[model samples]
Target: MPEPLTIMAVHAHPDDEAIGTGGILARYADEGVRTILVTCTGGELGEIADPSMATPETLGEVRERELRRACTILDVAHLELLGYRDSGMAGAEANQDPRSFAAADLDSAAGRLVELVRRHRPRVLVTYDDDGFYGHPDHIKANRITVRAFASAGDSSAYPDQGLEPWAPDKLYYTAISRSAMATFAERLSAHGINPPMSNEDGDVPPFGTPDELVTTTIDVGSAVERKRQSLWAHATQMGSNVFFARLPPPLFNELFGRESFQLVESRVATSLPEDDLLAGLRGVPGGQRHSPAR
Candidate 1:
């Protein structure tokens, strides 16, 4: 087998990684691609919907352990946490904490990410869309800092102490949720007798979902769907009964579109939309050969 392509996913919290690209990660790993999960925080303030782990006292620690287990399930080649506090949701009290993610030192936070980029030298970088996948403050913050880091890390003048060797990621993607996906998911919810979250009623879906033209990158993680399930399960505190995923008819969904979808936000490779695969845009580059990394 050829050397696995290196990919890095930066997420605001432990569960975000699995929630956003668990399937993609599994698919890549199965194809011998080296995948790394960069979690910014332990998600110390996350909700514990799991009745079994509902105790307020143990939730943080439990969630942290769960994140590690999820990384294991995803076959992550490496896992690093930037050690910030969860900013909680939009207006939660946690956001008020001086050390909370919302209050995290942007320069310092970004410097940590710069170090990772310098070390891993990933060709592609992944993060939530500008809305931060739902405009969660922490998610937005992560997106902001990561984008800034991506732009600056490649410059020797920026944060030289973080290890000046610059490695510019060729492409940056925003993991998007589409209206079609929402419609499909709603149908699934009805079948399962589960009500959708109240916040979703406004139809205020983010723009990344249905791009004027989406470069569709499909990963057939048919075999890795089970791994995806375990990876999601690892975020037990957030997933609980796995309600969000239960909406999707597994393996079938995997066979259909698999675990990942991304829109090229910044790329030196390809400019056209509706890309069949992520690497499709980068096909001209030797390491960027068009190979479906998922199942």
Candidate 2:
């Protein structure tokens, strides 16, 4: 039998998958593509929306439960964790923890990801950019490790000690939010009399998101928005039950969360710019037939 088409995403925390990549994960899984999520941190630093639900010491485990449920909702086939704690925000005291993803040695952290790459032999790999989507320390570290694994997983000369054959994925993409999209989301939030929740945990909201011109692909995930919202709801500790996001009307929710953008950082396969499908240009898609929803 032919190998099932596979795509893998590496994220910094439990809820990260739901926010940026949830639609793709759900959409691809619906198409019978194997979806894998590698969560690098335990999300121990995430705020507990309700104190009665968990304490400081137990937040990580609670978030894991949430992560599992979110994955099920998205139909992610595999969920892997590198077992590092959330490396709070930049310059925070949590950054000092040796087990925090940001503080872990790059080679060491990335080696763990390389092993997964070789094991899964996914055709496509995805992660955040060097900015970690909003300058989160753990996000940045996830980017660093993902970039490393993407480069080394296909090279036998790298990480040979792992005893797995090297496997190269055809494409590497960075999840991104175009400046225009961010502006639209902000406008919608204002219309609802809600503040833009761009703050990085307890840290100041640094200049966030990607420039519009830099975005190379936009996947319309309108079909999967319901799953995406439910997955986000699974992380209710970070996003409240009737929070600003959940409170948005369906049209607005679809307008804001209906699409996901990506930057084609590197690719072993060819594809047209402004692609509508992440699986475009791969063997099955035949020159990347557009899978994005019709506008």
Candidate 3:
């Protein structure tokens, strides 16, 4: 039998995996692809949304358990934690902590990810865009290191001391929320008399989503929507009952999140958009081909 296809998703915190990529992870895992999740931190600085779980001292441990439950719900084949502290929000004091993910050395952090890439030898890798989706410091740092690791993992000279042979991924994608999807969700929220989260007081859209024209791929995960919802609910301390995701009716939630979007940042194989499969043209290629890694 051929080796099973693999996909690695690098995320900034525990619950981020469920929020941003749970559908794709669940869908692909169900289709027999090996799904690996690399969480960059333990979410030590995350707010405890559950009133019962208000002990900050144990939040990291609590979140870790939540992450594990989420992985099971998503059927993730492997889970790795980079073991850094959460950096909190952009301008917060946690950003200054040397042990925080946002304050770690770029090359050093990338090196750790490179080791995972070499070991897993995934055909595709997923991570955040340059702005880190919403610009939280830890998210931005995760993007930097993931982008760097994508390139370095294929270069034999980059980290020879890591003791693994270089292995390049066939494709790299950035998780994206398309403007059209955002607009639809905003309209739905307004119809329900709830203030849309993406709109400002002036009614201008926030700098949160990618332009519709720039979205290269849209994966329809309608079949996996329930699994995705279950994964999200697993992070109880991070997502309370009043949050937008939890408040949405099941039908509406499926309508909004049933499809996921991605920007194909780097690809070794030729493929056209708007693509439905993240693997695209690389599925039948023996051992897959490597294009120049993203710089």
Tens digits of per-residue lDDT for model 3 on 1-295? 7757999999999989876799999999989899999999999987788669858889999999999999999999999999999999999998999999999999999999999999988888999889998889888988898888877798887899998988888789999998788888788877776666656786556756888887899899988999898898888887776676767777777777898899999877789888999989878774432434445
Model 3 superposed RMSD (Cα):
2.0
In the range 60-129, model 2's lDDT, one tens digit per residue, is 9999999999999999999999999888989999999988898899998999998998888788889998
Order of all candidates by lDDT, from best down to worst?
3, 2, 1
Candidate with the greatest lDDT versus the true structure: 3
lDDT at position 246, candidate 1: 46
Kindly report which residue stretches of model 3 are placed more than 4 angstroms away from their true locations once superposed. 201-204, 288-295
> In the order shown, what is each candidate's alpha-carbon RMSD?
5.7, 6.0, 2.0
Colliding pairs, model 3: none
Q: What are the models' TM-scores?
A: 0.84, 0.91, 0.94
Please report, as a residue range, the 10-residue window in candidate 3 with the lowest summed lDDT.
286-295
Residue-level lDDT tens digits of model 1 in 133-171: 777999998898889877766677778776457767667
lDDT of 3: 0.86
Q: Pick the candidate with the highest TM-score.
A: 3
The model with the greater TM-score, 1 or 2, is 2
